[model samples]
Target: MTLKVGTILEGTVVNITNFGAFVDVEGKTGLVHISEVADTYVKDIRQHLKEKDKVKVKIIAIDEQGKISLSIRQAMPKSSRPVEIDWQGERNKNSGLSFEERLAKFLKESEERIQDLKHREGRRYGTASRR
Candidate 1:
């Protein structure tokens, strides 16, 4: 029943402000910061939330004075979560290239790409005069 940081709870919206919304969750209360309300820009808090509205919020901060700050952003559905990019195509787990070596390889590849684009078909480096 005690509110704790990182705890997720269902709450009712008691008030809505330009900055954020206030919710009372599990007999405890907290404020959902404006920046933490949603993933996209919110020009008006009322557009997305309203008084007496039900929402799920995640407790993010609990001050020594028991002040609780919450985030509805953290409770966003997984479908709206950030997509993690896999770099496995760049290197395997056992690749031994050092940082400097990898940088050098990257530079070499970039230079080749630029050269390829700059030159016309079959007019590559050292082959300008040839057919």
Candidate 2:
């Protein structure tokens, strides 16, 4: 079968590697990179899949060498996904704190953390060497 981008297909996991999983798709083997295995971070690919596992994957790219890139996450329906938090949006929602107030607070906290780190380094190594 001719593979095309965005086409969803059923494939059997033929091999597993540290970087990704190889799937046999209708006689054509494609790679589903670990990062493409899920919508979130995957520390270990084995945790999410196993050899011979039947999985649904979406065709993401096809290179000149016929190396097919697939994504299992894209094939999954969006409704089942976890809510992704936007840190910037959350900070903006704090309407009570002005930009200047936030900046000042950040600077003060950063200074305190830096001092603490320096103290820890000095204790651990008899003093941190100056660059």
Which candidate number would show the highest TM-score if scored against the true structure?
A: 1
Residue 46 in candidate 2, Cα distance off native in Å? 0.7
Q: Which tens-of-lDDT digit does each residue in 1-131 have in candidate 1?
A: 77777888899999888889989998777899899988888888888998999999999998888888999999877888878778995587527888898889889999999877766544655555454
Maximum-lDDT candidate: 2
**Candidate 2 residue-wise lDDT at 117:** 94
Q: What is the C-alpha local distance difference test score of each model?
A: 0.86, 0.93
Q: What is the TM-score of each predicted model, taking all chains together?
A: 0.68, 0.63
- Model 2 Cα lDDT, one tens digit per residue, 8-111: 99999999999999999999999999999998899999999999999999999999999999999999988878777789887776668888988898899999
Question: How high a TM-score does candidate 2 get?
Answer: 0.63
What's model 2's overall lDDT? 0.93
